[model samples]
Target chain A: MDPGTVGKLIAFCNNGQMQVPAPEPATDPRRHAADTWVVIPLYNEISVIARVVGELAAYFDHIVCIDDGSADGSAASAEAAGARVLRHPINLGQGAALQTGFEYVVGRNEADYIVTFDADGQHRVEDALEMLDLAKSQDLAIVFGSRFLDDRTDPGWLKRVMLKTVVWVTNLTTGLRLTDAHNGLRVIRADAARAIHLEQDRMAHATEIVLKLGRTKLPWREYPVELLYTDYSRAKGQSVLNSVNILVDLLVR
Target chain B: MNVMWIQLLLVVGVITVGLFLARPTGGDSHLALRRLFMAAFVIVAILSILFPQWLSWLANLIGVGRGADLLLYALVLAFLVFVATTYRRNVATNRKLTLLARQITLAQAATEDSASIHRPHEGTSNDDAAH
Candidate 1:
């Protein structure tokens, strides 16, 4: 979380102190935006999915929601909101849904980048667009959204500690030092996304993803993004004890 | 102090087997090893049943106070192994299920996309004919 560490990571990944220039207005940000697919793994968030999808629909033409067998009409809502919806016959957890989205997007030849967004309304669309732009402009294969890079997102004291611990574990296992371990917002170019085959069908997939993406050895950078942890998102947020399950899953498999 | 050796052996055996089974490998050799272990277990069961005195003699050699105690320890160890193997199998099964479900979802999506595309084309073709 330290600025010095982030600077070192940026230097190491870029192999020099490179500055990211602001996106030029003449280039038109939406020129290639159609090639970016926003993949949302929907579980039971019926109340906010439509709004989330609607917001994303404004920028990205290809927004796919993988509905993980929600009993509620979340898939219908997402579909009605002008986004493509893929439904699983049964609930297979978030990781499975994300993998389904990844496979589906990669199978299609249109998308150049896949943005994995959450359904809980925690992530910001603006941040997603910025990350996509950064990936495109910098020619980076992966850009992970890290809330800890800045003080904009306050995840509380305990949650902060737990997240830091998870990040430590993730970095140790993946050999990629990231400030955030489980943030759902990521921009993955199609080539790097193709290299990912996530077998972790649960929360552990967060760590598994970092490990697999690291193995690809593609250029990656962590971008500072604000996570709007509303009351709804906080209610649906992962409990600190779930980290134990993630650890066991990583160790046993 | 006499029973220390049995405790040590049990602990070491449990840890070793747990570590060994934790590795992710599944094929004909792994299946064969599982069957060999089952065969050894069945032989031990038969020998203990046929020659109950031999169980006590072996237990004494291993520093266990009684044959029953040794049997209980072995049963516990076997139960743990069963649990471990079952958990691993369940994980493997879940992975397969995930892949299957993903394939179904993707296939269904593809069909829907094609159908929608065809529907729009049908509408446009009708418009062209009217023009």
Candidate 2:
């Protein structure tokens, strides 16, 4: 929870996420009128949407939430949290929601960097600030937050094994020595992020982005961070077997 | 009655066409099964064509003249249906797998984005404070 530790985490992520510095003092900048924009792609996360948005809104200039056809009041909750809500007509999945957020950032002049956040309460807002700082400092095209760097805060045996396998396969296929290849936390330069078109409107879009980034040789960096797996997250989670399905999807797609 | 060669040719032609037409692409397991089905179809067709007299004799023994031809046709049709159904099921399963995979990928990206979104910055409320 230490902001300094968060900044060090960002630094670690920037430096190939190799050296994880101990938690430092939180010297990261506050929300500037011209700083980054936070984009939270939400579905049915009515319980925690407002808190997530309210927290991130304090540090970022704009908070845009793509309500991906949530049957619940996720959009209203996001709005209550002061997020500019964009609703999908139907459940177009998370990739489409994220693409909408990127589009919002690209169309606006106020955003220099774009941060993708989840609607679920799993991810903290402060991690976004660290990534923003790191992205700016390294002049990176894309900054991906990895959870595998700190061997201490690892997920259980099954997840660790599955993620390591995914990282291995992705590295083999894409030739990017990235650990935790499936971690979602990322900060992208507005132009660069927008330039990366996410064609797959489903989960495969994540793999697509990594592959495209490697193919394009965009200056990318991976940072290590902790994964907040709440009871709710554990309940709503997909099984590790889905990783094989993802691989097959990548093959067919 | 003596048109056994013609019948044999007919069976061979049908099998050749089936093999040429339904060229499915997938893993080896399915390829093996499809090959077996093709082989069975070819054998059945050849048996029915080459020995019409034998088929007629078998039918008479079973109290149904020329019934073996009907039986052969039924068997082939049933086998073909089964193979076709299996292929369709596999295709549907693969499609669903594709969709599920896509959803997982997006969820992961959203997760990464969420983490990056939460990192603490100076001057902001201590949101990163441990619960």
Candidate 3:
């Protein structure tokens, strides 16, 4: 079978019943109109998180940070920078950390729209409001941020291919048709956020959520968002080889 | 002959004791009964092995020498069946508990997700829903 078709099948399987529209010309995030809360799940992001928090504070009304048992002062720094902070007793994986933030927001009845933002400073907070706008106009339940949109610049040859392959595979499993499937930045309605239960404890948890969301008949959209990788982000990250472990985990469970 | 009478009485006493100790705890009661039955069977086996002549004499006095051996075989088979059934039930219960735990965790995540999205914050500015 063609790789593209396989990817779509895989995505469809994972997404359950969610529908993705045919590809169209790229557009900016600012065109949507809903209220949004920026949620950043962090673990030892004390190095460059202040700027990420500041940028989000400038654009969104609510900023939530989950300190996933970081030994460093990442939680305090994020709290000091004005984000509502929640701390895990021990190091849960990023999925658990994101769940904690999602729970906190839902518990307080604070946000109608939720955006999962990375604390590593690779995401541009300025585009957050734009994504919010897009979500509102389209009445989308979930909006994934895409770095591989028609108008967006590709990060590099390696990253571009790697991300595209992941997107294709995810589409095959979940039935979601996204250009940048693994992009961490995503905006979702609070109801959809609550309905999609994620049990994955690590990075694979993101895939789990996307797959579950696709299974539901909820409405979703993919919008162009920017990724700015600095020296700091590259130094702290693991290679794409780690995806092997995620695949193994998914299969075993 | 006197010793043989005492042995017969001992076996009877053990059987009686086993039935008397059975409780009403449903599943465990049956398990306990099986264990007691096995223990009685072990005692009978040891007595027969130690004094085959006495059993033979007692079997004749009871007018059924072969019936005693058949009863012993029945007890052995019953013990084996009880052990197998217990093990199978335990394994089945463990699997059910695992599935239940997963459901509970997912339900918790679902509840948390809903609460965070709907609950309003007191101090936080209400950003308009992007549309």
Candidate that scores best on DockQ: 1
Weakest lDDT window of 10 consecutive positions for candidate 1 chain A: A16-25
lDDT per residue, candidate 1, A196-216, as tens digits?
Answer: 988888999999999999999
Candidate 2: list runs displaced more than 4 Å: A1-15, A21-33, B1-131
Q: What is the C-alpha RMSD of each candidate to the true structure, in Å?
A: 4.4, 12.7, 14.4
lDDT of 2 at B6: 38
Measured on C-alpha atoms, candidate 3 has an lDDT of: 0.68
Model 3, range A76-167, lDDT digits (tens) per residue? 89988988776666676787777767766766576899999999998876556656655665577887877766545556777677667676
Descending-lDDT candidate ranking: 1, 2, 3
Chain B, model 3, TM-score against the native? 0.42
DockQ of each: 0.75, 0.04, 0.03
C-alpha lDDT (0 to 100) for residue B55 of candidate 2: 65
Name the better of 1 and 2 by TM-score: 1
User: Of the candidates numbered 1 and 3, which has the greater DockQ value?
Assistant: 1
lDDT of 3 at B129: 46
Ordered from best to worst TM-score, the candidate numbers read 1, 2, 3
- Position B98, candidate 1: lDDT: 88
lDDT of 1 by residue, B22-123 (tens): 787676776798899999999999999999999999899989878998999998988988887788778878888988888899899999989988887887
**Chain A TM-score across all models, in listed order:** 0.90, 0.87, 0.83
In Å, residue A123's CA in model 1 sits off its true spot by 1.0
User: Where is model 3 chain A poorest over a 10-residue stretch in terms of lDDT?
Assistant: A17-26
